[model samples]
Target: WRLAEKAAVTLVDRLICDLALDVDRHSVGETYLAHRPRHAGGFEKEAEATQENYGVAPEILTQSQLSSAGLAGPFYGAMTTPIGFGLNPRKYVAGLYKGAFAAGTRFFDRSPVVQINEKGVTTSQGHVKADKVILATNGYSSEDIPDWMAGRYMPAQSTAIVTEPLSDTALEAAGWTSDQMAYDSRRLLHYFRLMPDRRFLFGMRGGVFSSVSTEAVARTKVVSDFREMFPAWAKVGISHAWSGMVCLARGRVPFVGPVPNMPNVLAGFAYHGNGVAMGTFSGQLLADMALERRPALYPAAMHHPARRFPLGRMRRALVPPVYAAYHLSDLRR
Candidate 1:
């Protein structure tokens, strides 16, 4: 922080000397003293060394490479951003996996398997058997289980954006040459950083998003957002806006492993937006559990079978009043 302050003052001096073209000895002396920049961010302290342990950068598997048969669908890419400019470097990454995954295992089970229809009613057709049954649906799941197991899942969204490349002039003006990810502190927070290419990607929570969304809406929000967050980026444009449906548990933790009492069936998902790391973590742990027969899984509040909040019409009626009261309590910024 102290270093940043010193550099900020030096920047102002350079601006006055170059832009204002203040060359006179007396004018230069006065400008140097008066033009020192004040710290807009109250960065008061500095910390020492920190350590990180990052693992492998996993490869992106394609349709042909999958022995398990990849989904036939569209492929997309994006960038994420976190808003806090000077602090919280990893807040964005704190919620992602740079690259991590474990190799898949093959199973040739021929015993018996059970088939449940879309309605979830078990049907007695053909053979009901399999040596093993695994549910590898990672997030974005919606299926009804028994009342006892209903609390074990969810479906939520993750929104992200990517910007067109910035010009050198624009980059200099923004003074964000150091490309690092960032995010801010909010219950529903925004996270972002830069990309391998020169573009920026920012992501945040809270928005009703879908695949049918239009480019106009995405670019409008992103470009308007660019003007506000980065006024110097006048020529920049938004190239894309996309969303991923992530799973969540009530406790905001991953819901992994076998369903409490379900026989032979195993499940792994419920990332809570921190999946890149936790998802793989759960995978490794689950593998270990299956091999060693230790704890098959952890309890998530979402899986807490006993949770009963206001639902249906009651939720519709009670939420507005409670939400309005929350907004009413906000101070005039």
Candidate 2:
């Protein structure tokens, strides 16, 4: 976890200094708000650990302090960690893409990798042979592409909704005008933030299937949960709603190392939904490994390979029962 913190810090520094990409909707600090009394104690423990380990002081907010922080709901208390930040991901990625192109990185669009081997990869259009290859594909990975990816990663769906820009009066009514990124203390958590444009972005994890009808159902579920969490915005119109897959591993941690039995092939995935900074950090480590150089931040957790999940291709069947248990646990007082 400390290494992950370092990765987040390095990511922020590189974005501001090395890339020099000025983007909007970027702000530091986050609060892990607790909505239940049972969940409040964990915040204090987290704050103490963070401060003691990293010398970074985090504030633990009381119930009254929650209101002062511009969050309105049933939250009991919170731990505001001043480590990470929230940004417009689309803008950040665009800037990164432009910067990489400027740095002479060749990009081949419309070419989906069909196979990967020690020599290189075979894409839909043509085969590109190289001495070393990196399999950075996360949730969209194909099981048969390398055969090693099967049962080693799990793709879970996360849905999000964006409200129409709220008026000052609306924001005041909700008492949630702050722009800090925040998430509740639930196993299946909900992350939200007020963007610079006054739009409220709320996201959650309840999806287990991928289809048109299932997507609609997931959207409805998220919207319902959003309205339930913030009653003041019950009537607010959602301008947009979407869902995407995030990779997960059996070990519940990220893996960034060479593929088993394939020395020239390196793979990195399973960020558990924190693919922004961790993904960038993993890419750097992969590059270092490819060049046979020591990485600046290659922790033991990351170096450890991910074990394959049970039931092989049928592993997705494991989600419903697990989600059901999580839902029941979150409902407990």
| Cα TM-score of candidate 2 | 0.96
Tens digits of per-residue lDDT, candidate 1, 71-96, equal 11111111111111221214322222
lDDT of each: 0.41, 0.85
> Which ranges of candidate 1 are over 4 A from the true structure?
1-129, 136-138, 145-152, 208-211, 214-223, 293-333
Q: Which candidate has the top score in TM-score?
A: 2
Residues 79-154, candidate 2, lDDT per residue (tens digit)?
Answer: 8788778877777788889988998989998999888887898989999998899988898787887898988999
Could you estimate the TM-score for every candidate? 0.53, 0.96
**Residue pairs of candidate 2 with colliding backbone atoms:** none
